[model samples]
Structure formats: C-alpha cells, structure tokens
Target: MRIAVAAPTGHVGRHLVPMLIRAGVKPLLLLRDPDRLAPDVRPEVDVAEVDLLDADAVVRAVSGVDALYWVDPPPAGHNPLAEYKLATASAARAVTEGGVGRVVFQSSVGAERRHGMGEIDGLAATEVALNATDANVVHLRCGYFFTNLEYQVDAIRAGALQVLLPVNQPMAWVSPRDIAEVAAGRLLSEEWRGRIVQAVHGPADLSWQQVVGIISEAVGKPLEVERIPEEEMRGTLAGFGMSAEQIDSLVGMSTGFLGGFTPEQERSVHSTTPTTLAEWAYTELKPMLQ
Candidate 1:
C-alpha cells in the first residue's frame, strides 16, 4: 500500500516512516524541505514538496495515494486554531479530490469538547472537518507527550521541575515512539472502517509529582517541583517571544489540563505500548541531558 504522510520530519513522522517501510508499505512523504529527510531513507520512498496550507498543492501531493497520515505541525506565530482549521480544510479537500481511501489523523485528548480547550480546539476542529470528507478517518486521540519534558532539561538538571498544572493531578502521557507504532499499524491494516476514535494513552496515568519522582530517581538527584500559577503562564510564554495569540492558546491548554480535561477512559490492552518513563529517561532523556 502507498501512504502519503504529512509532517514526515516531525517527532512522530520520523519514527513512523521507518516502521511503514518495515511493514512492506511505501510512504510518500510530504515535506517542506525534502533535504531534511535522512539521506538513507530518501531513495526508498517518494517525496512531494508542498506547503500544507495550500489546498491545490496538498491535493496534488496526495493524488494516487491509498492512505494518508495527517499530522499538523505547531503553528508559526499565528492564530493556532485558525491555522489548524485551514490545514484540515486543505487536507479534507485533497482527500476528496485525490480519492484517498483512508486517513489517520494525529489529534489530542479532550478534543471531544468544542470550547475552552485552547490548542486542543484546533484538533477538535480538525476532527470535525476531516469527518466531512469521503475517506474513512481514524482520530488517534493521544495524551500528553512525555517528550515535552525534554524542554525543561536544564531546569531538571538543576534539580527543579516546573509545571503550570497541579503536581498531584494524574494525566496520561505517551511516548512518540508508541504513537508512531500505533499509527503505522493502523496505516498498514484495512480492518477499521468509517470514523474511529482510538484513545492512545500511555501505560500509566501519572501525576506531575510522580513523573518528577521518576525523573529524580533516574537522574539520581532530588528534584523540586514548582507549580506556576495559570496567570503567570502568559507572561512566561511571552518572555519566550511568543505572540499574544500563541501565549493565550498555550496558557489555555495548560488551564484545561489543570481542570482535569484529559482522556477519561482506561488504557486499552490493545493500545498499551511498551515504553515507560524509566525507559524513556534512561534512553532519550538522559542522552539529551548530557
């Protein structure tokens, strides 16, 4: 089967591409810069250089593909909700025009609700728009990314872990590799039909304190947990040069998480992946720290 993948250079896409190849499926990568693809993988698959925001370009790129793996990358200094809507609309148009048979979208948890969801609203909008297309769609409602902690490596190394949410609130966290595995399996199989919503949660629902404890144990250092207030999140993001819209969106997401807006279902036996916090820390997180 031939599958077209958007954001092929992203965190999940980078892992998914190799898995697709191993499963005896061909991947047509839609890349902004084809050179960003690993040199070894380039000769194995087809490449299409196209801007996702351009409906005509996306339509051309997805033409003749059997399936599509759609992942919207983080927005670049614009209204994230509006940007996602445009991208989803473009992809939906392409799927209809190109006659793509199936689509597996990378969406987040709590996308079932329509409002007060900050960045998640974008995924919710994407889900609604893609559902309107003719092709079969599967929404992988993923949880918080464990890799997001990598951004705080410096602070972590200094024995401090900061978060906007309460330290004791439990939230599901998934590894990108696990997400890739599930997505690859879905892309390779023809079992699922129509609209499917699969909650891709991690092995455990852990609190911020629990996660920090794991990290501290892995790093062999006592770590301090600092919970920043919701109001301070805007100023913190703004200090990083994020625009007003971006700040509002990010803060909104944090607020939603603090309000217990994550996936409510138990982890499915079929969806439980092999990777764990300790494994990820020993492998991915530790290497980055050094």
Candidate 2:
C-alpha cells in the first residue's frame, strides 16, 4: 500500500520510514526541502518537495496515496493552532482531491480533555477538521516525550542536573520511537482506521527527579537535580522564541502536573507501548550525554 508522510525529515519520521519499509509498505515522503531528506530515505523512498501551505502543491504530493502520516510543526508567532489549522486544511483538501482513504495524525495526549494549554486547543482543531473527511481518521494522541530530557542532557554531562520545572511531578513520558512504532502499526493495520487510538505512555510514570538519576546511571556519572524556579520558566521559554500563547500553554501544562493531571486508566486497553525511562536513557540518551 502507498503511504504519504508529511515532514518525513522530522525526528519521528527518521525512525518511522524505516519501519514502514521493513513492513513492505511504500512511503511517499513529502518535504519542503529535499536536501534535508536523510540518507536512508533519499535513495530508496519516493520524495516530493512542495510547499505544505500551497493547495496545489499539497494535492500533487499527496495524490494517489492510500494512507497519510500527518505531523504539523508548531505554528509561527506562538499561535499553535494557526499552523495546524493551515496544515490540516491543506491536508483535508488533498485527501479529498487525491483520494487518500486513511490518515494517522500525530497529536498530543489529553487532547480530548481540552486541558489548560494552547496545544490542547490546537490539537482539538486539527481533530475536528480531520473528522469532516470520509476517510478513516485516527488521532494518535501521544504522551509527553521522554526525549524532552535532551534539554537537560548538557546539565547531566556537566554533573549539575537542573530539573526544569515540575521537579517533583510525575509525568507519563513515552519515547518518540515507540510513538512512531504505534503509528506505523495503525497505519498498516486496516482494523484501526476511524478510531481514536491514544498511545498514552509506557509501563510506569516518573518525576523529574527520577529522570535525572536515571541519566546519571546511564551516563556513568553522579549528578544532582536542581529544580528551576517557576518565575524563571517564562523567560527561559521566551529565549526559545515561543509565542506568548505558547509560553502560557507550557506554563499552564505545569499547573496541570501540580494540580494532579493523571492519565486515564483505560489507555492501556486500546494502546500499549512498552518502553521505560531507563531503557530510553540507556539507548538514546547515553551517547548524547557523552
């Protein structure tokens, strides 16, 4: 079967494309710049460079695909919902025009809850838009990325670990590679279409303090977890060029953690991904710390 992947050069895509190929499914990778295509994808996969916002370009890239893997980047100017809206609309048009039958959207966990953040709202918009299509749409609401620790990797390397915010709060963190695996499964399996499959997290949950300890062991170094103050978080986020809305959204996310935003118990029933914090730390993060 033919699958069209948007942003095939992204973190998830880098892992996802190989899995799809191994399963005997052909992936049509769509990117804005072909030069960014990874070596593995460039030579073997069918690729198209087109402006994602351009309706004609989207249609051309998506045409003749049986399935789609949608990944929309954060919108410009901190309006998280705007870019997703644009991408979703463009994809919606392409799905109709190109005869694509199924779509696997990469969304965040708790999207259905509409919790305190612009991310929830933006994901909700995309979900609503995709629901309009006749094609089977599956919204894969992923959990908080364990890879978020990459930001703290430097601190771990330096033997001074700074747990950003929500230091004591436990989060259900899932690996991006595991998320990609689940997405690949749904994209290939016909029975999963038209379903809202939420890959909530792995076996257990961990607080930021535990995360630092795991990294310390994996990297073979002793480190201390120094929690960052809430007041400084806004400025730190601003340094990353986040919009006011985006900054507020992230700040609000920490509030949920503090206020007890636990994962629903039913997540294991529909979606089961088995990758723990230590496993992720040992595999993906250990080398980065070195």
Among these predictions, the greatest lDDT belongs to 1
Residue runs of model 2 more than 4 Å from their true location after superposition: 76-78, 160-165, 226-229, 239-243
Number of backbone clashes in candidate 1: 0
Query: Which candidate comes out best when scored by TM-score?
Result: 1
lDDT of 2 at 186: 77
In candidate 1, position 167 carries an lDDT of 86
Off by over 4 Å in 1: 262-264
**Residue-by-residue lDDT tens digits, candidate 1, 141-252:** 8888888988888889899877888889887788998999999889989998999888888788788899989988887788889898776767777788888878778877
lDDT of 2 by residue, 1-290 (tens): 89988877676787898889899877898888888876765777888888776768889888888899987755665666566677777877887888889899888766666656445666766777778888898888777788777877766777886544567777677788887888898789887556565655765667777877887788788877777776687888899887787787667655544566655545565665788888988988888865
Reference-based lDDT, residue 12, model 1: 92
Q: How close is each model in CA RMSD to the real structure?
A: 1.4, 2.5
Question: What clash count does candidate 2 reach?
Answer: 0
